[model samples]
Target: MSTEVISQIDVDRTRGDFHYPEQHTFDAGTGLSHATIDYISDVKNEPDWIREFRHKALDVFLSKPMPTNWASKDLENIVFENIRYYLANAQRPTRSWDEVPDDVKRTFERLGIPEQERKFLAGVEAQFDSEAVYSNMKKALGDEGVIFVGSTDGLRDHPEIFKKWFGRVIPTGDNKFSALNSAVFSGGSFIYVPPGVKVKHPLQAYFRINAENFGQFERTLIIADEGSEVMYMEGCTAPKFETATLHSAVVELVALKGAKIQYVTVQNWSANVFNLVTKRAVAHEEAEVKWIDCNIGSRLTMKYPGVILKGRKARGEVISIALANNGQHQDTGAKMIHAADETTSNVISKSISIGQGRATYRGQVHIPKHLKGCKNNTECDALLINSTSRTDTYPAITVRGLGNSVQHEASVSQVSAEQIFYMQQRGLTEAQAMSLSVNGFVNDLVREFPMEYSVELKRLIDLEMEGSVG
Candidate 1:
């Protein structure tokens, strides 16, 4: 219960050994150019359309300037010419864990992928650097017409399904980073569920970045057929590096009529990484889509997962939690667009700032005039652990329909010394007390996560809080 004990907890948290020796067989040498894109396309042996798609997206990326108005000035430091766009040890993914390369398997073992798969996951995909080294799904789900594989495999084997929805949700021109992802995206999940089939267990993916001064661009797409239900979860981590790393991904989801799709992400990048991603979903008639996102560590992260209710009675929801430590910035939020009658949406965001860290919430909710009976609710809350810590909230809600209703609420609170003292008197250390208080702040939303993820989230928050106090 002493201050020294709490301080030690902080030290232990940062003592993790995440470094691994680079064992790549191929590297697309540093920089972004037409040649790099063409090489990536040729290496994949992709269809001509896809190869052309990459070229067009590269042009779009070149035309757009780095966004400076809302993002941190750190964005200017990303030297596109110095970052290696692709690095892979193997060309094909292995279905059996034993077949995976020893070093790659060891990396996943450290991340708890195999154990988690053995315990409860319906499927598991592991991506190391720019390639999915391992991918497997439950035979039962496969029998029910579930297709879960890497994007490359999906396009090659099931073009009918993959081609129809690949870039429909989030177009290549959606943003600068999205265009970058489209140009050189290598490893990401591709999921499709048949109509009326409900996946009982969650499908999971783990992405690890092991190389320094490199970029990982994974493109993921999910399509839930009519009356089907599926839950997909992804986790990401990068080893500590002195040089900056880039992680730019694009995820798109499509929920068909009367279907439900839940997408969850637990992103814990190292302090030297820039995590910029674009994720969006579209909900059809009577369908539902939800995004549960948690951002813990990154030098600068700018991500906003969004949903578009495209049909009558569609629904969308976003629950986000962000924690910023010293020398880190967590800029995250959600977007919802109601394009049909009787659509509904909700947004709940929570942030924690500690030791000069900064957190920002930028959200948007819109309902057009033609839509009737649309509804929306948005809440943003922030907790500051130190006077030097800072937080910001920007919620933009636009409702043009007469029968639509929208509500927005925001609050900022700081951890009080008295509360910490009281908890310490109760036999808890300062670190424990702070961790408990911070956990309680987001307990309501954390419970929304699956049991395993919630436990891991709590552990991450505890470690983060340890570093914040004292």
Candidate 2:
């Protein structure tokens, strides 16, 4: 399939220059000590059980050795004692955006959060550094049985619902990073829609990292009740830094019988970040789950959103896009497991690499022997901007059922210098021309995003392409 082209719009190139709040200094002190964990727990007034959970997780993090075989090698350089565990510029989240600290509000305004919320979002949560500062839900949405807020708030206010599902999908012992997130995780979104309720607009959460040696571990859980539908979006940005920051998060989603859920993420971290995240969902009878993920601008990113089709007639789809610029590595894909009859899945992945960057897709699709009528289709495409860049696709598909149908396809291509030379001859500067071609390479998957976000994604791609020409 060809990539979709995005129409050029008048953009405020100056807007990217808007400054954000400085990292809260007092919270910048390092070391993963018991005292630090206690401070975080006390500040949030968390339950005793959670404090103990953090301590247990810290032990696991300290004892566990970094996996040597994974796509990430930079993770070995992380000094556990050199990172700050928690930070908060605001003691509590404000219901009204204006009530948020002026500097914090300015940060969101810089990112166009307010404008996006006003124009298209049903709800918006803004988190800076380590804590959610502003969370607002449209009254009409709140009135219709929707719960949208930070994970901390969810634990405090809705303990019954929150406790039941927290870590249920991805337990602390699932993996090293997942355990770490369970221990010190804070400031993520928890959303639930009542049975049969369908949200008209997307809900979004924006995460910004303002500190130098900080690790942001946010935990998000989304549950769609029977016959319900909900769409959630997440975006991230961090300023340029010399030292790498760690962002390892765990996201779990559950789609009940006849329900649907779509999770979208657009990450544009600076090159000084190791973005390792775990996201998975469970779909019941006749339910559907989709993951739309875009990854760019991180030193190393390892994320593969997965889904388990647990009941008959369930379906899952994952559409992903990644771009790796100089010194960056984008390692991401998806997983689909069929557990019942008549389940279906599809995975479409696209990646672009430039200036010695590397991109890889690692994915799996499994259908057990008892799962009859299972079907799956997988496609992976890679684009190389320069000869020095690299890309790879590794897919493992297992079909055990007699009637299962599975197909896998992969293609890799390099942008011909002729394409750029052609565009340059059309009156476009070299940078603009290369940007247009790279944008064209990934536009089809980006079009799946909301109009506003699609525009932002293209602009970010363009910004990364600047100075890319040799």
* TM per candidate: 0.97, 0.94
What tens-digit string does per-residue lDDT give for candidate 1 at 122-178?
999999999999999999999999999988788888999989999999999988999
Off by over 4 Å in 2: 1-28
Error of 2 at 288 (Å): 1.1
lDDT of prediction 2: 0.87
Off by over 4 Å in 1: 1-17
Residues 89-171, model 2: lDDT tens digits: 76578988879888878778877899999999999999887889989998998898899999999989988888888788887
How many angstroms is residue 216 displaced in model 2 relative to the true structure, after the best TM-score fit? Answer: 0.6
Assess candidate 2 and give its TM-score to the true structure.
0.94
In angstroms, how far off is 438's CA in candidate 2?
Answer: 1.9
